[model samples]
Target: MSSIWRTMRGIIAATALLATGLGTVALPAQAQKVLHRGNGAEPETLDPAKSSGVPESWLQYDLFDGLIMPDGKGGFFPAAAEKWDISPDGRVYTFHLRRNAKWSDGTPVTAQDWVFSWRRLVDPRTMADYAYFLWQVKNAQDITLGRKAPDTMGVRAVDDYTFEVTLASPTPHFVTMLHHHSTYALSKANVEKFGADFVKPGNLVTNGAYMLAEAVPQSHIKMVKNPHHYDAANTRIDTVFYYPTENQEAELKRFRAGELHFTYEVPVSQMQWLRENMPAELHTAPYFGTYYYAPNLTREPWKSSKDLRLALNLAVDRDILVDKINQRGEIPAYSFVPPNTTNYTQQIPDYARWTQAQRDAKAKELFAKAGYGPGGKPLELEILYNTQENHRKVAIAVASMWQQKLGIKVTLNNQEWKVFLSTRDEKKFKDITRHGWIGDYNDANNFLELLRGDIGKQNPSAFADPQFDLLMAEANTTSDTAKRATLLQQAERLMIEEMAVMPLHFYSSRHMVSPKLIGWVDNLQDHHPSRFLDVKP
Candidate 1:
């Protein structure tokens, strides 16, 4: 039998055996004793600088310790650094490292490890997409842009246990940024010993509560408690097994069979069935993410006419899309900035809102103004979506809606997730592309600043505007919360007016966890299976 089939059979046999002979293996008093997480994609890499996908990042958090860590309440707390001091000018930050911290290999972790990691991230040779995250560090941008050498980075090891960093400006989210995996320290010894293979499963050394014990590409990964961790006592789980299963049905079957403990990104079609049948274990959270369609503004047709873009934007029925197509808990989005971000207030005007009649009238008017009307001149557009079954369903639904509402013909192209990401970044195919962005930090700027003309180059679509860029720049420097919110709101308005991107919905993640699992907190932004917090019975 195939390995997958064998595994499935093994799970069934184990459950039956447990019921028949409870005395063979002592059952713990608590409910769940192990956490089995399932994901759709396998991690690409474990190296913090090279990792990009959610799986890799989530795993990195378990195997590495950052200077700061998120407290699961949208705030920062010390991790490797026991405490810190900020200069009155908000330019310099001094961190006091825990003297007892040690790497998994038993070597003491030092301030120099952090300095090395920071310098490596900004190195041009690294080609790290997340390098921009370090822009707040003094001379980091210059180093990344090749204007300054990597050696000139503004981090210094004051001593074996002290580190100092200089920032170019007062970044309000500076402390939070430290919690990101990109800011985590790497062992120099491991890097030299393993060379380019430093991040390979067996060759890795971690400083966090858990250490990577096994990695089976495209299959599963397993982690065990790290005895060398500073706070190992708080880590209750002995081992964590993560399986990569792309099919939601398969995941559900495994969960029901007691082979898996938890699964996320629940299939929209199964939400009703799970809600009714498994209501006790179902969990949902409003995620800080935006699903949108991107138009290749650098390409033809979409390039010359802003009216056509606005017309297409207005044609999308976000309410219907979120309610019908995205049955898996999603909020219809009217703006890019998700609600509840820091400094956000409901008083901020929502520029994307318009009455149904007004939207239809405006769409019709723009279509006619652009020399195209219903059945007059059919605009042939290609829409790209990932091969995930739910995403394909959404794409087909949206395509049909556009054809029926605006007489536009859209061809849907579904590709594997990895290929889809590459093609989108290359800007090679399709006029419209489906994409989503989950917040990196709980800040409105993270969403609004991504649309800046220069920054848009990093994004898939080539949409840009000088006015929007200026507003984003001003918001970054403005310390006053109200003033900054105003500037960000203005920038959001510009995006809506131009219709450079169409906001579809604010995603809400749904999942099922075994009743046995405890201390598993739900985080919208960073949805990692936090092993340290979970206690298995």
Candidate 2:
């Protein structure tokens, strides 16, 4: 017994030495709680300005934090900015940086760093898709449009630690808008020194809970806790490993094998099995997002044919999509906006209430009017979707429905995430595309603004309407809550009537969490940042 005890003590002492001395060595979970998370796809870029996907956003949440972080209760708390103040009119905001907040290079995070980052986000050279988000800030849109110089924008560094922002209008949700990853500050010195290569793992200077220790494409991305992080002493998980798991079945297998602590999403086909077997681990709840199929309206033959767009939308069997394919409690979506949006009502179109048979008949009639039917040109098209098993299943099911019901010839085109985004953004695809948008903020504008003409790459459907835009613009800036709601409803009704997209279903987040993982709480946003998650020792 005395010899065994001595051996155990030596082993424990050596393990401690390895953890401290070998910085990149991954320690056992018993000694250091490491989280292995299964991400859905390979992240396109870690550069916050160039990222537009959920996978990249998840990494950003840990690798970089903005002025304030969401508190998960429809509120926020200070992050890089230790405290803040708002003006009486709510148009101006002031942020006080934490004195202890330092970048990975041991440099203090100053207010000037934020100004440079914000200006770069809207600069035309950067080509950031989320640039529309900052239009609320004074002169931000002008700078983005090249009408004004970058430094002329509203954000200013009052001092080394003080940052002030003046908005174009009294935006009540302006502070909420600041919580997005796009607003996260990048070190000016680092960018000036490294240029485009700054995003490389070794060159990146992060100011969050974790730093990019290594990234291996299609395999795993390894991140270690940042010693310079303001709250590093309080952070629970010492290391995080994210795996690119596009295959749901394979991800589930790994989970059962105890290789993964969490899954990005569960396979819909295995919903029943998960419920019966991993009831405690299988979590399904309402998510603030919508899944839809959009037609490219930029060029023919979809360009001059509104009837064709309406016909395609009517032919879709949304009920089957929700109840059959995605059976994890997803709601059949009719409007572009999710009904979960606070204090807002979804504008359900007239065709939504019609039975499948009724919709099919109407679709046939519309197809005939649009110069396609049994005696006319044969209707054929393709749907482009990113590489995912669930998306493939949905494309196959929906194609069958169109072919059998409306005699429309349909084909499916699948591409990896990065390629698919480029195809969709460039409007290179001739037919329909499957797209999903998870809300960034709780407000209705967060979802509705995607269809705006000036939204850049996000507006893949080419939905441009002056009246719709006018209504939304007023709704976006109005201080009167009642008037804003009315305007938003009008814009949505108009867009739905115009057939901007075929709404399939509202997403219900279905993920598997290991029992060993703690501090897990379900939320509508479906955001679980690493700082709040922990692994049991």
Candidate 3:
């Protein structure tokens, strides 16, 4: 804890206005009953289907409710839909919508709203990054690929209060998929009437516990309780405020100074300090995420160089990188799948368990096989990463190791968040760039699908092994849990051996929580919607 910032109450009070200086006026502290928390960064977009970042999720989960929502445990509870039933074959699901559910504008939330949202998501014009998530639905892939019309999507409105979904196969995780933000219902009237302004304060009509009151980019967002929400009476917090705090240290300072009630992340450097001073406030939970670097397989040099890719993956000392650079309780990732993933058992490659010297020898052998040697010719490649203190340190360390071990000249490139996302998505980077995949659902398919050939633009690495694709397809359609896990594990092993992407570390959710906060429970997903939380006076 930074006690110095806590003591400087006068400075905090003076800068309060300046800190929130975008285009909106901050509500007077005395008049507003609001819970304030730190959002990781400026939201790229608020459109649930189109948005693809963590910051947006923090707000979206509160602004809208899907058919199902996480219950602060691994299991899920109904949100918009009161209950649902599945057929014996598991191909069809019938959702029973709550009759009292209404949008923020007091209009009845009907089954048609969900149908409209699902069609909009799979429409090619929307260019939703997570559209692949709907592939399990009947004709969803063909619809998104432009072969079929969006209306042909599997979701249908049986009536105003009845909704049905048809799947291409018996997907065990289909219900859990409804918990994602992309599956939330959208207001057809509001979207058409407001156009791009539909998400704005007055234009937006949501059905969650809170509605977007105001949003000032790069500054803050204010959400007030929605009177029309079915369960709004249970929402203890009348209002909630989210601040964009990219710098973890600055976020911690704000939390200490009473400017923020909670933070999604804390700087790794200050973890020890927080544990020593405020152990109860520091919360760490297992997260389903993988941090890796995706090498551009469509570009030259790397496009034809398999041995070079192997050498690079082998040279990385993940243990050292995780301990010294990212000391935030992250585990060095030898495989993409993290521990305790649903149904799947972790598999570590033989090379990952080898001694440092043994791995170096193998890397040298691979480089030599590729006709590149330390004295003969120097191999050069550029590593691109987003602008973060920890990322930079890790990149530098990895570069130094490559230089010393393989005599490869490595250059580091840094890009801002939005730019980095564009560069990676556009596949315009020269060599390799930093990448990460947080599970959309509690299934291995979410991570494994990234390497699939038909995954669209998200497959930046351009890795398409026919064998790997076949295994993934089999795993998707397989209903037997144990057999499905085997197939998925085999696909993962193939991906690792091919070095499609270099898995650096597995993440853990490390956040600063206020003691006054209530209704927070650490879960595997690490999701805590503001609607479920209340602040103590």
Candidate 4:
């Protein structure tokens, strides 16, 4: 670890030299308008279609412009496509591209770029895990399944400035989906020139408010204002430094020392300290996300023993987990969807209504029925989680609950962010593992789709229910927003009732934001694009 850290530091130093005209070329630095932030993890990739996790989103949102951009509030505003028209049937969408919009290289951003990028995302060869998002587009699913060609995937460049799209059904949230990274346009010429290395700092060509200046792996990602951005005149903060500091305590120390302008998370244990000492800097709000643990259903115990799964789910004391252990303002979640999601009602499980004593009794009854008990060979399992201090605390606390209440033996395993991502994607974990989901859009379908068996590896639990799949399909096909919402609610309830995964708590964004940073607001998404912010100069 020490050697790795040293190497990362060396790389950062070399990149800084390149940025300061020590290498191939010289670029002027204007006024040193820089914002330093502490990020939770290093991004594994910058490719929009393949990227997942919050760390990647931080960079992607700045480096590329989609047709529409999320406002951090519930609504979306125009980006590359300034205006668009939807057919009365809601199946066809015609987008009018911004003629003045240009890439970092000063070339016009044509509609062909968007068509090419969207087709690449849904193409089977790309294997983008988020390709399921394109299922709304006509022939997109067929193309991804290898039954149709990419050219036939319902996206067409009508002219240099006109792009046309056709959806399989009337999707109310289709515009919301356009704001996601998966729908961002990529520079086809640059992608072809660099191939797999297209996202490297010097090779990247972006059309957003900022473009990649330098990227040092595991150390920092530096971005500068994009000269060719349509709204470049309004893009404040000439440079943004994203430091991947996963340890919350370490991040707090940096923030206290005035080295960081903002941090992505605050340690739960330090909440009281922050409140008492630096109350003005601390901020909190309900975020549209969930923290849960998924049992690997392909293996033994979890796959064969439904009674055992129920017992384990009932064993958790979410009230204690949130109120005592977490101490943050997170809501204890009984359902997959959170309470504040738009257009849908959150379901409350019957077990959630039970008292702690009642839950304990029910767990014990289920355990005994599953043929595992205190005396005759206690059930042994391990909980896998990413290496975060807060996750460790929660794991230990939950482990204690299982041991004390059900007399089950539990072991804990930890991995870093990159390894954990692969482990979850490849289905290599043995038993239950820690997992979380943040909605891509403010819709119930985004959360419920994770469990759809048709998604393949995205459903880490490998859970499959034909009835649930049918309900979701029906919901997607109908144009009635009310009926669609009802179906989604039913689907979410079905998922929670079966105990496919243990829902721990709905998340709250706890962080420290310097008062000097202007235009920052607390929203349910907790997404504040750097383009909207400026340091008090």
Q: Candidate 1: misplaced stretches above 4 Å?
A: 1-33, 72-75, 346-352, 374-377, 526-529, 535-537
- Provide C-alpha RMSD values for all models, in order: 4.0, 4.5, 5.3, 4.7
lDDT of 3 by residue, 65-144 (tens): 89998765556889999999999999999999999999999999999999998889889988998888788999999998
lDDT tens digits by residue: candidate 1, 458-520 = 465777788888998788776677888898888887887777777788878777888876766
| Candidate 2 runs further than 4 Å off | 1-30, 72-75
Candidate 3 or 2, higher lDDT? 2
Give lDDT tens digits, candidate 4, residues 1-537: 334336557866776788787666655454457787788987878999888788888788888889998665545799999999999999999999999999998899999899999999999899888888989999998999999999998889999999999999888889888878888999989899999999998898998989999899878899999999999888888888888988999988888876778898999889888889999999988888999989998898788888888888888999999998898899987788887788888788898999988988999999988888965557888999988899999999889988988898899999999998889878899898999888888889998988988886678688888889999999999988899999998888888777788889999988899987887788888787888888885
Models 1 onward score TM values of 0.90, 0.94, 0.92, 0.93
Count backbone clashes in candidate 3.
0
The per-candidate count of clashes, in order, stands at: 2, 0, 0, 0
lDDT of 2 by residue, 394-413 (tens): 99999998898778889899
Task: Return the candidate ranking by TM-score, descending.
Answer: 2, 4, 3, 1
Cα lDDT over the full model 1:
0.78
Q: Which stretches of candidate 4 lie over 4 Å from their true place?
A: 1-30, 72-74, 375-377
Measured by TM-score, how close is model 2 to the native structure?
A: 0.94
- Native RMSD of candidate 3 (Å): 5.3
Which 10 successive residues of model 3 have the least lDDT summed?
1-10
- Looking at model 1, residue 232 earns an lDDT score of 83
The residue-level lDDT of candidate 4 at 207 comes to 87
* CA lDDT for candidate 2: 0.87
- Residue pairs whose backbone atoms clash in candidate 1: 32-516, 32-537
